[model samples]
Structures are given as structure tokens and as C-alpha cells.
Target: MGQFLQSFIFVLIVIILGCSKHATAAQFKGYEVKSSSTAEFNESVVRFIESQKEFLILFSKHSAFYRFPKKQSIDIQIRDFLEARSKTAVKVRVKYNPMTAEIQKIEDLKN
Candidate 1:
């Protein structure tokens, strides 16, 4: 009887863990892009964006990439990628600063 009860309790715990709410909720991620080291930051940002399936958020108001000489090329690439993804059923939000966290501009690709 003792062994059977232990087995049942272990199975119940497993079921609860497997059906966690976070498993279905959208995940949130953040990245910091600085003007002095945009190369690495750009690469990381691209990877992060690509891996996302449902949502994306960016926080970088003073990014140097905007001031770079090759800003046009880099900007177009990122913009094009986001535009393509935005055509799908994904949600995207970007913030230039943390002060306006509640005022996220949501981009619904389904539209």
C-alpha cells in the first residue's frame, strides 16, 4: 500500500509540472545595443528575433547603428526581416526607452 501511494503521488506531481501555464504564455526577452559595439549586438539581436515565434521587443534608443555610415544597409536588412515576420501571426513591440514601458507599439502581422 505504501509503495502504491508513493507512485500515485509522483505521477500527480509530474502531471502538474507538465501542464504549467508558462509553457503556453508568450516569453519576454530584452537586449541592450550600444553605439560603441554594435557588431556583436546586431548579431545577437538578429538571432534573438529569428528564434521568436509569437512576440518580440527591442529597447535601444541610443543605438549607434543609426549613426553608422552603413546605417542604410544594416537598417534595411533588419527592417526587411521584421517586415516579413510581421506579415505572419506574430506580435512585435519596440521601445526606445524603458520609461514608456506601458506604451508599447504592437505590430500584428495578421493585419
Candidate 2:
């Protein structure tokens, strides 16, 4: 009986770990933006924005303002639209907290 109980507990632990891994995998499936333009800002934020261009375009077109939560010192949001060349054109607006010098929000303008 004791061996059976031990085996059951081990199985429970394995199941818990497996579920946690799945949760993390799901979390990582979301899109992130990364900026490629020469605009000077925090490199990390730029990278993030540039990476998620598809989401950014949708966000800019639909939402009046898109915000990056206060997680790091430099948070940047990129606003993008199409140009005459059919290329993606982007403008970056930044908001920073004076006390912390951290970027709080970024807004992209509509064409």
C-alpha cells in the first residue's frame, strides 16, 4: 500500500510539472514587436516593437492609444502605417516617467 501511495504522489508531481510547462509554452506563443528604424530609443524596446509589426499595425489602426506597461526603464511603442512605396512606415512617440526615467507608454499615429 505504501509503495502504491508513493507511486501515486510521484505521478501527481509529474502531472503538475507537465501542466506548468504547457502553461509557459502557451504564454510564449503570443506576438512581440521589435523596432528596426534608426529612431533613437532603448534598444531593447525597439527590438521588441520591431519584432511584433503585425500586432502593432492592428493595434495602431484600431486603438487610439497603445501602452506598454511599466516594466523596464525604457519602454517604446511604434506607430506604423503604409507609405507610397507600399512599405511600412513608422513613427514613434514616447512617454517617460520623470522620477524613474522609465518609458510608460508609446503611441502610434494613424495615416
Candidate 3:
């Protein structure tokens, strides 16, 4: 009886592990962005926005504004462009980061 119980427990553990792996596989399916500097981030953002099919997500850090004093105007232009582009069913999501002063990541989610 003890041996049977141990086998059942092992099978249960294996099943749980398999389910967890599948869940994580579905969550981490986004493309990994590699941009360190603000310039790199801006370039990536433009490219991503131009090529995005479904959604474009950009993170604007506080430092980006400080680095480029004229960034506010550029940001406005970007938003206007995105808003225009989004008329064709594309979604634009811009998030602000107050804690940090650096761009974080650019995510292009295409469904």
C-alpha cells in the first residue's frame, strides 16, 4: 500500500510540473527587447511602431525627458502618429515610469 501511495504522489507531482511548464510557456511568448540607451530605445520604438500589426507598447522613463529637453514635443508627435496609425485597428499603449529615469523596454505585441 505504501509503495502504491508513493507512486501516486510521484505521478501527481509530475502532472503539476507539466501544467506549470505549459502556463509559463504561454506567458513568456513576447519578443525580448534589447535596448540600453535612450537613443537605442527611441530607434527601436519607431521601428516597432512602424512594423506593429496589433499593439505597440512603449515605456517612457523620466530620464528620457531630462536627457532630451525637447523630448516632450517629440513625444507629442509620436503620440499623434500612433493615434493616427491606430485608426486601422492597431492599439497603442504608452506607460510612464516615475520611479526610474530611464527607458525600460519596448514590447511589440502582434496578434
Cα RMSD of all models vs. native, in order, equals 13.3, 14.0, 14.8
lDDT of 3 by residue, 1-111 (tens): 999999999999999987865444323222223334333332222222332223333323312331111234234444444443334443323322334333332222431
Task: State which candidate has the highest lDDT.
Answer: 3
Tens digits of per-residue lDDT, candidate 1, 22-71, equal 33222322233333222222111222233222224332433222111123
lDDT score, residue 105, model 1?
26
Error of 2 at 105 (Å): 14
Q: Tell me the lDDT of model 2 at 34.
A: 47
In candidate 2 the C-alpha lDDT for residue 100 amounts to 33
Better of 1 and 2 by lDDT: 1
Off by over 4 Å in 2: 29-111
Candidate 3 lDDT score at position 96: 27
Number of the top TM-score candidate: 3
- Misplaced by over 4 Å in model 3 are 29-111
